[model samples]
Target chain A: MGGHELSVQPDAKLGLHKNWFNKLTSAWASGLGAVTHKELADHLGGKRLLILLGLVAVTGLSAVYVAASTIRESAMEAVETGFVFLLLFSTSGGSLPSFLSFLGFLGPLLGLALGFDSVNGEQTRGTLSRILSQPIHRDSVINGKFLAALCAVSLALVALTLLISGLGIELIGIPPSSEEILRVVCFALLTIVYVAFWLSVSIMFSIVFRQAATSALAGMATWLFFTVFATLLAGLVADAVVPLPSEPTALELMRHQRIEMALSRLSPTTLYYEATSTLLSPHTRALGPISVEQLEGAIPGPLPLSQSLLLIWPDVAGLVAATLLCFAASYVLFMRQEIRAI
Target chain B: MNQGNVVIRTRDLVKRYGSFVAVDRLNLEIYEGETFGLLGPNGAGKTTTILMLLGLTEPSEGSVQVVGLDPTRDPLGVKKVVGYLPDRVGFYEDLTGKENLLYTAALNGIPRKQAEERVNELLERVGLAEVADRKAGGYSRGMLQRLGLADALVKKPRIVILDEPTLGIDPEGVRQMLQFITQLSKEERVTVLLASHLLHQVQQVCDRVGIFVRGKIVALGCVEELSSQLFKDEPYVLEVRAQPTTEELIRNLKGITGVDAVEQAGDTLLLHCMSDARGEVAKVIYQSGTSLLHLAVRGRSLDEIYRRYFLTAEEQTHRRAG
Candidate 1:
């Protein structure tokens, strides 16, 4: 039987003799579209999205309200600054941080919640094998899922930003200038990228851990470590690297500060804070330690929007690169995985 | 079985996981529009073979051709026409059963209008129309299996592979699933490859069965052909039920030329014979002035054939080791 001659029959039903490249391209397109549509519906209609959005909305609105009231009390001083609209995001009042700070703290939680179970949940449900058996490239599953979650998060962030801007305009009685609006749009876009980085990290965790609960915990652990402990750890490392005494000279002090700054930037939370602070405060001229000699001839006015963006370009690029790296890690792991129902 | 063109062929296929050989030197062929069963015990490499056939996993050696296209090279093309129902099939619990089927239809690139109509018709065909609107989470295991069958057929695929479709279902559910598979192949003219560990269940629906043991097929043919081949050197056990059994009757039964031994238990007689001797034994019973109540031959069951092959394979391994 093994040595019997066998004839290969051409598949007439599927018309396989036509241009192979065209067939493959069309198959990939349809598969990706179908997966993206299905995952988008799942994300938008899920209760998880609703709960996370509500948490962000309530906290964000309260922070904005506090900042708005504080700005109104010092309305003349803020108006004189010529960027009262930006003040609504950067101003802090009576024990509450500004809206930008609140977003920086809470945005990762939203990302972690959306992606911590994206891959492992399907495996446990026994749906992974069924979905993969479809006529699609294996990468389409992960790509479509990431794309859908990003869309949902983008929608939530945009809506929240617009709502706060509307409330600020009504309460502070100052419409944002064109530059302020541009800065705010940049802020919104930067926030999305930061959240997307966390989303990719959580997705990577989901792929590495078999259990959904374990993956969720891993994501939260990473978030907590970066958010709370990273800065303190950086400070300890800097002190160890460049010991500073009470009687140290000015040069030594600058050296310690620079080391601390460099170490702290390794954390994504720190990067997000530095980037958003520069974008929101037009009057900000420097992000790092500067000598009196370098500042002697500098003008005492707000920097242009382009200069501010330049000051934070490295931070923005760092966030985008981190997002892509995490996504790429998860993509490689998922593709190599043996997808058996277990 | 239909003598149509061979739709699936594998030559010298093998799979290895580290040092463990999962499938070894497998050679198989399934003609178009035939229901073939890959029967084996658990861990007999049936699922591995099925995965290789579907292009879900690549073989370590040799090659596989499905519908004349190499699975490793053109998996998407093969997948376009081959529908697979995995063991313990799962659905998105949050979605309704109808929605799950529609999702599969969409993935296969069926138009929305056409997919909806086909999904509805399949839901009706699989007896899931009443609960089509309910979330799959609320469905029973049997209902899920039926929904899986409906999902596999949503694209009107030419070949369908079902791995343990009856694994966890109740007796009645298994019977219904077997009936559905048989009807599917007969009515739709679709080729079916069913991988299962349950021998009698596969025997009910499959036209040809390949008894797999230890990553190799020991027998491959129709049921009768396999039975005849395996039992050529073994004697057939003829069980006879009669009233008023006597020594003379036993003596006379053993006197038959093909009968090798005869034993009497209560009102029944067990006769081990080289060939079928039911007619001669009946004539002897009538001659002895005793009434024959029942007669049955017991070596032709698939369960027996599977057990025989398993024992032989185990003995061969032990001999080689020794």
Candidate 2:
């Protein structure tokens, strides 16, 4: 059969008769949609992702359980009971950090893990060049991956948030107010933005590094620096820049603390923590050190949701800017990169 | 320069990385419906040229057009019509062969129904229908090559650019692949741009070949023309073996008009001619006292031509440095 097929002459070559305009049909949406679907499926089904999900679920519910028990025991005012849901996510309980804290600390790692190898893995598999050779524009490949990872993070965030809310209702026997739910949703969105920043950074590393393991390590190193060392480094810089007297005046001490806080906020983890704390805890009025004089003028009441959003708007904007900058850098690098694999 | 038959044209097509120029001012015209081979050694910039042609890599300084569309300006259009098979073809390990094809088809915007039909047909065409449902990771190198070929053809591209398609395949697989490539050009009318360091592989199928050296086209023409060019003033060797003595026959053979020289070695006589002068020499041998037993012509081989051209290129480089 093989010999017979070999003897069979191929028909005359395809003529130059294809409608050139038909070739111009842009499949950007379809291509992006197809790639996103595939990647999302891979992420969701991945064993590593499952393990992370299980860990978050166990840790989150345990904290929620402890916070709910405390809220039930201290339930003296009905009007203020709705605020207990916020405490469930914001305050650490029973020797464990709050669910929001866990997310702020560990969420970026998930994003980084998902995306660190997105581009280079395809290259290593030898599919990056092939997919780029397809009819879709080069932009779609990276955009699809970013969008898919963001979608996965967003899904996990929403599911975890709802689970906490459901547990709060069951454990405390009090449903959260409409405002609390709104804040949780906004917090969920903020967490997605925070995670996406790391995703873009990881993808940039992937494009810069050929090996998947190398990119993953780089991402982990950055995450560790921001999470563990950024604050200590910020304090050192602050103290070195603004030396405190042995018996410092109030103004000097305030200046030293302000510098430390400002420098520490440079880390995405700090930004996310501040933003989520403000969003999840309405009683929290300020992110920086408050002067005693200013506290004397403040009212002993919960601020409105709008006020909380306004307070953390800069942090939200910063997270967005960082995400876009990382994404833009990766976009330019990928576009300018030579297609031939090393 | 936008002639209808000129399917692909590259003028001053140079690609540089830092100080290294991978492709230097290459000018080429590949006509429509012709299987043109870009023949060269490793690092000769054949892959870079192909990348520029596909618009996957921008040329530092040059221009390229494929199917009348500037690949740089209209890469999607060029890519739509041009199928590319990289030297190291890769597929998603977990996806089935058919799934991989379908994914490529989707990216090309082929409707799902049409993509399914086309995928099955290509799978069968590549003799991989039985294993279409198997994961690509389990496939052998030859199977993967065929799968890559099918992937390239999934969109029914007018031009197929194969970069070292037979690079790592077994000898039998190489022969089959070469045959498949020829069939693609002959039967399907797909204009093929097969780039390879293997001179013999391209020589077996290419209608025209461009030999590259140090990022420059050192030679370009059909196989016969290249051979003649390399052996320009050299004579064709014709050996005549006869059972009897040939002193008079050698003199008679020497009298032929185009015969350059004649020498006798025992029962065999060597005739050097500027061109083919076998007919006249045969008639003269019949008239001589000896009967003809065997007559053989030893023409310049492509291997010799390839070696001479590369050596000349090396010498030119050395001379310039000196």
Candidate 3:
């Protein structure tokens, strides 16, 4: 309360209001809280959100059950060094895809749905003009919305991971090691970053397109392109750029594979998949195709946590850059947009 | 006729959307503690002008000083004291009335305890105490409008701007809204700028009215002053039902110095006088031995004045084009 007090001259007309610096900073800080609270509530309580949650939950629990039953039979080495619990959480078992795969596949839709209506919906509801009339800075609204959606995604991922870990312990009759827990936590964080990138992209579209439905369509289209078509496109480009004969040298084959991998990594989905796989499965030492000559004399074991983190550091950085780029574009656009409706 | 201190002043303010000028070089001054109505038809740029004044939209040219603060440079400074209720007032349909106001208070950086107290006070003031806890979506149109008013005044702003406040309200709701607006201006002593396309909507509420047409203020003054300015030279009509409506009476009435024309119909005599010559006309009628049965002054309504102003403006444009 004391922080809220200002030495504003009661009778003063115009200029900066009393405690101008305090007001500006507080507008930024509290604007975050105000918008985040409302948006988080909307995301958590929304009917569509419930449907998405149920879909993820049903698919995730089934994957976990299958992975847990298999691990129960081979609990000895699985629980000691390797990240078996984390593997159960991230890997597909039998025919069902793992929880992480489910997130990778559907997480963008959740992010898109949360943010596609972030700006234009306010305009349609007639609240954009009203909210902007307040003492807060214009950019704070977009900032708050992005942060809130990110927070919602983080919470959902955390809850799901904890549920999977708890169920794994109950079904396998063994608790995970400290390193395994740390790796799972990192995996969860990386997933949040990946989803947040999509959220930022959706919010940018929301700002650019005044119609919520159109922005939503654009977000889904982008997600589908990255997840489903990016690999095909990357393969086609690789073939054209680095065509290799059927009996090409091993080095030439490796060069062609490198080119294709680089092209595929342009999509955020590829980056997220590579990063999460390394973090969730300690045995996953490399993301690209490796020749036997390179691994002939190498000792085969799970890499240390630091080595694993180093392996995927670039992917994590790429996800972070993409998120910031989308958010920054939206911020500049929102600032330049005229507040008045034509 | 200038009375109160000037609280808001705009000089040659212009807003252009590409080549289409939304507001064209408009100058306006609003006084403190006065309900200034911005009267216009649809697409008259009333909303655009208000947005510029609020600093929500930047002006292409000229400047605006609200409460002596340049809104363009110090929008937060202007916004801290000015309250605006857009034509379509929207609220979070999911939240209760109290929660919505509290959210706005937090956005304005009010302390939590004080915000709660203020939200309660505003909810009570707007006559929404009983339904304060209910979701706004459940509220009626009139209730939502009332909530919108409370939301605007939640911070106890020194100036209030309402656009079409009673546009979709029922007749009873319209009356209540007008009463509330009048009270807001008079009792609170807050400067009010109310924009409406309906002439009578502002007729009783605004102390001064600015008639906006086609991105410009075509006529601006106190309603009475504007009426006089528009119809100053037009003869005042006096309707009199007299006992003897004869040619002699008409001739006598016509002979009065200021009387421009006198017409007789049945038992009534219509006197078109250049000035208010009721006394002289009465004397002439008395001298003619005609007993005056009833005498009434005929004046034009604000609606008629609004129409004529537009008509004259149109003629001027036509003349210029030709």
What DockQ does each prediction reach against the true complex? 0.56, 0.55, 0.59
lDDT of 3 by residue, A166-276 (tens): 887888766788998898889888888888999999999999998999999999899999999999999998889879888989888888899999999999999998898
How do the candidates rank by DockQ, highest first? 3, 1, 2
lDDT minimum window of 10 residues, candidate 3 chain A:
A7-16
- The sequence of per-residue lDDT tens digits that candidate 1 reaches over residues A247-324 is 989988898999898988989999999999999998888889988999998888898999999999999998899999
Candidate 2 local lDDT, B211-281, one digit each (tens): 88889989988889898787778788888887675467767777899998888777777888888787887
Candidate 2 runs further than 4 Å off: A1-27, A70-82, B1-4, B237-299
Predictions in order: lDDT: 0.90, 0.86, 0.85
Alpha-carbon TM-score of each model against the true structure: 0.94, 0.88, 0.89
Q: Give candidate 1 misplaced runs (Cα > 4 Å).
A: A1-28, B244-248, B286-293
- For candidate 1, the docking band is medium
Residue A134's lDDT in candidate 1: 81
Candidate 3 clashing pairs, residues 3+ apart or interchain: none
The interface root-mean-square deviation of each model, in the order shown, is: 1.1, 1.2, 1.3
Q: Give the lDDT ranking, best first.
A: 1, 2, 3
Error of 3 at B87 (Å): 1.1
Q: Tell me the TM-score of model 3.
A: 0.89
Q: What is the lDDT of residue B187 in candidate 1?
A: 96
DockQ for candidate 3, please give it. Answer: 0.59
User: For residues B1-322, what per-residue lDDT tens digits would candidate 3 score against the true structure?
Assistant: 3487888999999999999898988999999999999998889899999999999999999999999999889998988999889888888888888888898998888888999999998888778999999998898889888888888898789999999999788999889889989999989999999999889989999999998887888999988889899888888888888886777877777778988877776666788887888888777878888788888666566797789887887788799979
